[model samples]
Target: MQTSLATSVPSWAVGDVTVHRVDEIPLPPATGPWLLPDATPEVVAGQQWLHPDFADHEGVLRLDSHSFAFVVDGLRVLVDTGIGNGKERANPAWHNLRTDFLERLTAAGFPPESVDLVILTHLHADHVGWNTRNVNGEWVPTFPNSRYLTSRAEREFWAGYDMEEARRQMFRDSVIPVEQAGLLDTIDVPAGGVEIARGLRLIPTPGHTPGHLAVELTSRGGAALITGDCIHHPVQLAHPAVGACVDIDPRQSEATRRELLGSLAGTDTLLLGTHFAPPTAGRVVAHEDAYRLQPVPAA
Candidate 1:
């Protein structure tokens, strides 16, 4: 079922680097609302994720195959790997997906083996699912030779905590395998910049997770930013205080949103959101009191 849908990676050149969206899988009905008790239809309106096409769907928000790709300085890097095969949880929708993320990666021109680095902004199940794949009964790094990058703080916290059962199970299935394979690298990006490649650096944008980081790219004097879960939906643009119910630290998430959005508004910086739909990249604009998304003009 994952292979039947069309995959698109809105591409653009930011100075010298080329970026693409190596999408994994998108849930139909795109949006409505997850099961958050506080979610109000009024608050979710006019959001791209909440397209009118989703009016018939109820109780759950469909997800999209939105992932970021960074091709710079002769290296190909994947910002996040969406939900992969065999991830089991209570949520039937996301339980054990047998996706062809590798095929999707190939469709995007960078086969799994071509990916030099896989950077996970946080340790959520969806983000790390593709870190490894089942190989003849043993789990192995999906991108055989690529280094899997994640935050040290996030790795330690989840590795040694009493988390919700489902999440802990996610760690056991999707994350630990990469560690055991010695393909995981815990990147420390507390400050703003830590070079990952020639022009790519890791920026600390912690909020949703204790060590959440956004990727910053610079080439020929131009810059772009991959905002991982900092702003889940554009509606959050109007109500930055309404952080995701799944966020571990709501107060910190809110503060990160304000600071990240405030700094990127009207700048040359391009913003890429994980759950944001195709044409996932955009610029920020300061609206009435909050903020607004100025999506890249369609090609």
Candidate 2:
């Protein structure tokens, strides 16, 4: 977890589907302490497996802000959009800033206009910031040709919930513009999850948000999962009890993490972390009692 943005985009192949990691900004050191308060230095140090790549020898957790891109069934897709270039925000890290995200996307072989679908895992400020971009004097949908998809429960829950000014401002700039353009669509995610295309599915993994989702893709018997915020960092795999401060329901979040990890353990499925540092993709292997990620280097 170097803090610098990579020049070459790293990608992994899941059967016929190739998932690319689109680098955003590497979150500052403070992000670890604030986001996962329970992942203290001592707690992080105990998990020796996280060293060097995921955490420093001193036990500071390494985290990043990025998205996964790939193509499935003739559809050029982007799982989640990272924080946009320039925007007003209460958080110092996410406030008005500039980054070469769009250029990076193009380098990965999927330009904004070429993307057929933009799958939003949830409506978090950072997750959906790129849903729209500042155009001229107003915010507008960045991918006008793309169909933005998310779970129906996700949008409805945020609609009725009391949101702070920061959140409301985020929606005004990043989310509302997409909706007003009539490009946003919601789907009912059943218990078994809903398949959108031949090999793409939306699995409901609520807790972070009532409608939070984890995208799943399969082709030729090979499979991969894009963990939105359900499993934020690799450390969580070792200590499933550790939950993010942003979780709406800590209990449910823990349960969801356990279930997802349990099902993937000892399987060949590749787990691509939305916020994981380099070697962002891995397989969940059963460790002592819980599980640990067996890093899968991108091909």
lDDT of model 1 at position 172:
73
lDDT of 1 at 97: 81
lDDT of 2 by residue, 1-299 (tens): 12243448889888888899988889988889898999999989988889889999988888999988999999999988988878889989998869888878888887899999999999998899889887788999988899999999999999998999999999999998999999999999987999999999999999988899999999999999999999889999999999999999999999999999999999999999998998888999998889999999876
101-206: candidate 1 lDDT, tens digit per residue? 6776777677888888889989887788887777897767888888889888888877677888888777777788878878889977756568877888888777
After superposing candidate 2, which stretches have Cα over 4 Å from the reference? 1-7
Candidate lDDT (C-alpha), each = 0.73, 0.91
Count of residue pairs whose backbone atoms collide, per candidate: 0, 0
Q: What TM-score does candidate 2 get on C-alpha atoms?
A: 0.97
Given candidate 2, what's the lDDT at residue 160?
A: 95
Per-prediction TM-score to the true structure, in the order listed: 0.88, 0.97
What's model 1's lDDT at 121? 88
